[model samples]
Target: MLHRLKEFYDGPNKDAKKFYNLVEEANQELYPGCTGFSKLPFTLRLYLLKCLHGWSNKSFTSLLKLLKEAMPELNIPPSYNKTKSTKIDACLNDYILFRNDHKDDDFCHTCGASRYIQSTEVDSELVPSKKQHRVSAKTLRHFPLIPRLKRLFMCSKTADSLRWHEEERSKDRKLRHPADGLA
Candidate 1:
């Protein structure tokens, strides 16, 4: 593994080799991630994750040196020797992108709300869960998405007969006379 670590060269121009996801689009400009310390740039943050995944601290430190030799802008090279405070603080904000914490039900998939609507809600069938998910028969085999299906209930595009049952309470409240509030 040490031999391969020193020799491995995954770069943008080299499609034959696969770079880890964090570093896959290093050169591309991402929304500036949480301001991390160690003065390391976001791209270098990705590089460190790749190194830490497999290599030990000592080997990672050595590898960081080699990377430093190649790219002057990479800031501090991988430092397995650094204090835990320094190492931990350095990666604090960069993990946000990895976790995809921005998954909001309200603004999902801006293109056309891919997940929230179905053409035919009542007649739609549940997709069978992949066999890999079967731990025990007691576990839910197929959970149908109903709330997402509800959005289409309001739209009468495909189902001409579908009716939106709206309670006429809010409209009546707005039309009430001011004298109703007298004590």
Candidate 2:
């Protein structure tokens, strides 16, 4: 491992060393005192349960407070905000992704459909002084690929599994795996 680290540091590509450093830093911050592919931390497990059961913020907070009081030694986050995931909204009619250049667009360019649901309750006679709250017509949650891939590679078992084809594949001239047939 030390030899690999040294080679990475002295590699021709500067980004490779930088990426290696970042992965190592992430491993430390994520695992901390834990060793050898342990179970998910209590806080993370609780957060997952909250999300899965759709627990309200008040309920989740109460549970955390109770747990903290009962187990003073355990480190529990005050709220679920610590484990927030990324999400984005998109056009409902055309399914046009609203991001980057089209982030602020109020309507879809392809279908000309409104991005937000039109409020029918608002009275036109009493034009409100402040902007009315708008709800998205539809939402599409997208998980980023890089962070997930980094997490998979961080685990020794998963990393080895990812490279199984290359390291453990039969070298005989026979089509065993699907990839072996690729030109």
Candidate 3:
């Protein structure tokens, strides 16, 4: 495994070969349940590698094609089309205020109001747990923006700019970045 890592580090065209091997190795190492890439029911490891590398579906597809040819012994997923579509469908399963139907019956049963219309309202602590239960399960998984913005500050390149809000504030200041928050 050390040899593979060293060879991978020194290898030319590092993007193509090393990524597949590393993903395969990591999958086997991390997940003891699955035997290897081919045996796993889901393409979770491949998806996670793409996420960690910040590769787009198209770029991952190209890499996957290269892997299929270079390592015939490895059983990798064929294309990104199905994988991407499935991910997209999963993400899109959540309801959007602007896009989804808002019939009057969708209102709160007790208050007869659309209290859960805005994402902020849905996520707010002010909303009772019982009321929260009234929200659609799909909408419950709506991704929060604050954590994602905070993650930007976690990166080395952006960490220096963590205090940019304070440094660059105007007289009529408004919250533009996550760093502006007291938390």
Question: TM-score winner among the candidates?
Answer: 2
Off by over 4 Å in 3: 1-34, 39-42, 85-183
- Which ranking of candidates, highest TM-score first? 2, 3, 1
Expressed as tens digits, the lDDT of each residue in 16-51 for candidate 3 is: 564455444333422334332232233556778889
Runs off by more than 4 Å, candidate 1: 1-38, 41-52, 83-183
Which candidate, 1 or 3, would have the higher lDDT against the true structure?
3
Model 1, 53-170: lDDT tens per residue? 8767676667767866786555543464531221111112222211134323222333322222233333224545423221111111121244225534545773443432233223
Candidate lDDT scores, in order, read 0.38, 0.68, 0.50
Residue 70 local lDDT, model 3: 87
Give per-residue lDDT, candidate 3, residue 64.
Answer: 76
TM-score of 3: 0.29
Q: Each candidate: how many clashes? A: 0, 0, 0
Better-scoring candidate (lDDT), 2 or 3? 2
How well does candidate 1 score on lDDT at residue 94?
29
In model 2, the Cα lDDT at residue 169 comes to: 92
Identify the superior model by lDDT, candidate 1 or candidate 2: 2
